[model samples]
Target: MSTSTGGGVPASRFLFLGTRAGHSIADAEYEAICHYAGLPTSRMDRVRLEEGPMPQIDLDRYAGVITGGSPFNSSDPITEKSVVQQRVEADMSKILDEIVARDMPFLGACYGVGTLGTHQGAVVDRTFGEPPGTGHIELTDAGRADPLCVGLPDKFDAFLGHKEAVRELPSHAVLLATSGPCPVQMFRVKKNLYATQFHPELDSTGLIERLQEYRHAGYFHPDELDRLTREALASEVVHPQQILKNFVEVYA
Candidate 1:
């Protein structure tokens, strides 16, 4: 299902593209995106890509585009991916072609690393996969100066959970943030296209919701759910959402 928030002018609307199969999960993610971006529910619009083909995009119609996490991994063998996953990736590639080619404003979180990295020729594999938990990030010199990094500390904590990660920086991208386990935590393509391996929209509560739904998704052993939940609640993650807020402020 797709949702359109009513307050923003058509030209100022921001599109959130989601690839989740579960409506509840996708809805939660969407709400978080709107929350952190400081957008009222009536202003941020969403498109659930798993529900159908991506509609044609007119970059000029919206101020910017944002995509959130998904269970789909680009590193999964083609033979192993579900038909829906394959279609979603294909659709995402088409949109990326337009976004990248035009240098349109965009921010992609989590699953975005895989899609955007693959499109930019970066090797996204299991080599740097990090477990679901708080991640420690240190900004590169370039990242410190990036407009999106404004008001963010050089080093801060953010919530992250992924099964695959970018093994190296893409040739056309500038490295923005780094973690020991995942060196390519964030990067920018051209000037406006950005992707983060971490979830800027997730907090302890958000992470717990995902853990409950994905307990059996191989992110971790199902038996660890309780402990993971406790850890998530106890974790102090304070700065990543600034990226989302910055994206909206800079572009909108």
Candidate 2:
């Protein structure tokens, strides 16, 4: 039972797990990630638990759960997997241990920052990663007084290409934002449990059309994919579509 378009509407329901599946990117980047998580593409239903066999929701049937981005690497090297990507990383680590033991309302991007930052114990590595452009991000002051990033735009535009991050931050995470090459670009493990190493449901013409269809599938450097798709198509958006309308106006 996969679904997400503006959810069932009694004010609770937004499940969308995927280690990569909504036609595997580019249906307008899965309709700009279910239209920035308020889900409205006629109800996006498909729990593509990384293409294995998803069907175990029940976090009160969801009012939040949005995981995306993947090339499969919850810190990989499991003999370079293929048993359905090691059973979708063991069914997303038992659904991220029931979404960090019920601190739900999760939002994960780029492999969910290595599957909820390596299941909340942090220390997932690739050594300070964040390649593949759209640099310049900043917002710590508790992420500018976060209401899911208050008043944004002191510098924005994020759509990173990961290799694993969050080298340390799990004692019930906090660290709102930072960048230079990535230093936990966003985090939060208590208040509605958020996460984002950037890719807040992409824009700029759907991230330059998935960077021209994954630009040889390597992020950057196919001779810099025509200068990173012309600076992700002349940059300047620096992200701010209301931060998903303040996460759908904080539970609408």
Best by TM-score: 1
lDDT of 1: 0.90
Clash pairs of candidate 1? 5-42
| Off by more than 4 A, model 1 | 1-9
lDDT of 2 at 92: 79
- Candidate 1 structure quality by residue, lDDT tens digits, 202-242: 99999999999999999999999999999999999879999
* Candidate 2 Cα misplacement greater than 4 A, ranges: 1-11, 16-52, 55-64, 67-79, 82-106, 109-111, 115-125, 129-142, 149-163, 166-176, 179-182, 187-194, 197-249
The RMSD of every model to the true structure, in order and in angstroms, is 2.9, 17.3
User: For all candidates, what are the clash counts?
Assistant: 1, 10
lDDT to native, each model: 0.90, 0.70
For model 2, how does the per-residue alpha-carbon lDDT over 9-115 read when each residue is reduced to its tens digit?
A: 55454666665544737345556777765667654544666555666555655567777677677676788777887888778778778777778777777777788
